[model samples]
Target: MLDQQITRSIRKMIEAREERVRNGDANGYGVDFFGMLLQSPVNSNISLQDIVDECKTFYFAGHVSSSALLTWTVVLLAMHPEWQERARKEVIQVLGSDTPSFDGLAQLKIVR
Candidate 1:
């Protein structure tokens, strides 16, 4: 199923990250995650595989939760045309009739 594929992909990515971390690649963000596990005061022998598993779990959970929230938000926005229109109006007002510049976008507190 699709779930299995997603799990496998996440596992592969986590394994790659773990290898990079173990090899002293400081540029990887995975090093931070690994460091947190290393710094834990629990008196247990945590293996590299365990760290990679934790990373995969973290990645999958974060992806699933964010995707669900975004889907829900889109559905809600679709159901509420008035709110969508209001949001569009606010965007237009902030951007003006021209292409939006960084300063113009910064002025849109409501959009932000």
Candidate 2:
């Protein structure tokens, strides 16, 4: 039952993205892994279930790695005050007082 709910939710998001793409809304489906998956000619023979499974795998793998990386990054930053300060300065210079957008985050070379 939980799996069904998750599948249904993902399906809805996929359908919505498809609709946006169909309507020529570039901003709506801007540059994402799943968007690329949806648009890829390589995926022509793949089923929605296959895509969903791939997404789940990507999500779980990314979640684990990202958590581990974040923990290590924090610990390393704590151990290295100079690098941490540099990163902080870079973030402040790139993002200023505003919340970090994709472009803003991309501009933060040190922190990235």
What is the per-residue lDDT of model 2 for residues 22-101, given as tens digits with 9 covering 90 to 100?
88875645456787556543436767788787777778678888789999999999999999999998988888897455
Predicted structure with the largest TM-score when compared to the true one = 2
The lDDT of each candidate is 0.64, 0.77
Candidate 1, clashing residue pairs? none
Tell me the TM-score of each prediction against the true structure: 0.34, 0.54
Q: Worst lDDT window (10 residues) for model 1?
A: 34-43
Per-residue lDDT tens digits for candidate 1, residues 1-112, read: 9756766776676566657757887454332544555433243576645655676677767788878988987897899988778878988877768655445666877556
- Per lDDT, the best of the predicted structures is 2
Clashing pairs in 2: none
Q: What TM-score would candidate 2 get against the native? A: 0.54
Off by over 4 Å in 2: 1-7, 13-58
